[model samples]
Target: MAIISLEYYSEVLGMNREVKVIYPEQNKVENFTGKEIPVLYLLHGMSGNENSWINRSGIDRLIRKTNLAIVMPSTDLGFYINTTYGMNYFDAIALELPKVIHNFFPNLSTKREKNFIAGLSMGGYGAFRLALGTNTFSYAASLSGVLTFNGMEEHFDDNPAYWGGLFGTMENFKGSENEILPLAARFEGERPKLYAWCGKQDLLYSGNEYVANELKKMNYDLTYETADGIHEWYYWTRKIETVFEWLPINYIKEERAF
Candidate 1:
């Protein structure tokens, strides 16, 4: 397996961004198999960057074992959100990043069957948010994600600018006026297979459970787990392996080999 860091200007971001990509190496870089490879969009926690996953976790090896390609992008302190202060992080993640990567490496394709999102902490929040926000993903997993934004007004009401650059108001999250709920209400569209795991001792545990409970009652397919641990890299790294194994690969794009 080989890992490389790439930095380039983004038309969507209007600034430079960095990405860390891990693949089985270019035994043949430009061969263009004409076959689409599944992609895992990995995210990092707050104060972490694109390299955080590769540098700190065994993700590189895991990707090799899974025959999966990992795409990790830097979010800085943006909470993976486009704030009033800067770029549209969500758009970058949902659109531009995938486009750029596919353009640079033809191995990547735009099909939903080959796309997945997974992350830890802040990155976890991002992974789930983007997964729920669009139809581009076939699956998603978050290890301790910030799953709810219904209270962001009271929490950051004074700072309505918290994530303004990407979205003008919190109402945008609610999906619509009749739908007074946030992503929770609008999450069922072609619901991607969801999985989430969190440490029982983690601060975000409650919210994580809230997500699972709500989805459960609504009959949204999901897998939510809690274990004895904290919100540390060790816990997240360990869970990454579990998530890879748990991913719904039984629905692989390839047809039955009989």
Candidate 2:
């Protein structure tokens, strides 16, 4: 596997951004040749950059056997939304980033079924938002995601300016494009398969449960799981392996020496 740290200028964001890419080495795996590899657009939690998944979760080692390419982008605290403050982060992730990746690595497949997205905490919200809001990814996973804003006032109340910048006041948030629940309900056409995992003891558990129930009512292809865990790297690092297992991809067998 080849791990590359890519730095490039983004036309959508109007700035340079860094993305960590994990690509499979074709010759290292058995029976892999001349085929486009599936890609996973992995996202990080709040305050995490492109290096979070690799540095925190040991993702590089986990997917060493799989013939998959992973693209991890840094979005600061943008929540992967278009943002009320004029940053079109949603467009960046949903549209521009893919084009950028494909241009750089033409071997990565662009088909809906070959594309996937997943994230943790705020990024968990981002994964669903992107999947439901657009028809790009065929699958998505959320780990300890903040699926709803039901009782999150206390967390945002501490920093009104920060919250307002992202959503432009909580009053207009519910039915807006930034909201995930409404998107899930109102989405039309083909829906991406969804997977969500939240620890029972985590603060976001109730929200995850609520959203999972709502998806069930809507008959979304969703798989929700829970266990004893808290909102931290330890839980995410462990659960991400399960996320990989849940993805609908054929794992490449590692070549063994005789």
Candidate 3:
């Protein structure tokens, strides 16, 4: 597996940006086939760089076992939001970044089943926010995520004005407890598969379970699990490996093809 770091300008955030990419190198791997590999947009928590996944989580190797393209973009302090006064980081990610990647790489499929999103901490929140709000992504996951309302206070404590701007009001955060599932009613997607898990020992456990329980009540197909762990990269790397297994990557079927 070879990792590529891309730097460029983006219209969504309206500034210079960089993203770290992990993919099987067609030049080195015979089976690489130079096809458009599936994409998994992994996000970072607040105050993190695109390098977080590789630098902290060590994802380059584990995913080499699968035919997935991992792209990690850097958003300094934006909290992955389209704020009233802050950069529209979410739009840049959910819309612009995918287009950019698809244009530069071989696209295996544009179907929702081929796309995925996952992250941790603030990125976890953004992951579900996009996976639920947008139709493009099919599979989504969050590790040690802030799964439910940590309350407007903690949300604001990070970026008071930004949170207030996108949501409009703290009240808007209320019904969101019902919105964390990756599936939306009458989903505009292929009814994308959902994956959300957090460490039982993490402080976010309560919130994660809150969203998971709510998803159960909604009759949504959710893969929500709590395990013994903590909120750190030590666990994220391993968790990501499991997430790849949970996703329906065709490589497995092809390997077991009768």
TM-score of each: 0.82, 0.95, 0.85
Candidate 3 lDDT at 235 equals: 79
Ranking by TM-score: 2, 3, 1
Span of 10 residues, lowest total lDDT, candidate 1 = 249-258
Sequence-dependent TM-score of model 2: 0.95
Please count the clashing residue pairs in each candidate, in the order shown. Answer: 0, 0, 1
Better of 2 and 3 by lDDT: 2
Write model 2 residue lDDT over 112-220, tens digit each, in one string. 9999999999999999999999999999999999899988876567887888889877787878877887898899888999999999999999999999998999999
Question: Which portions of model 3 miss their true places by more than 4 Å?
Answer: 27-30, 150-169, 176-189, 250-258
**Least accurate 10 contiguous residues by lDDT in model 3:** 249-258
Highest lDDT among the candidates is held by which one? 2
Candidate 1, pairs of clashing residues: none
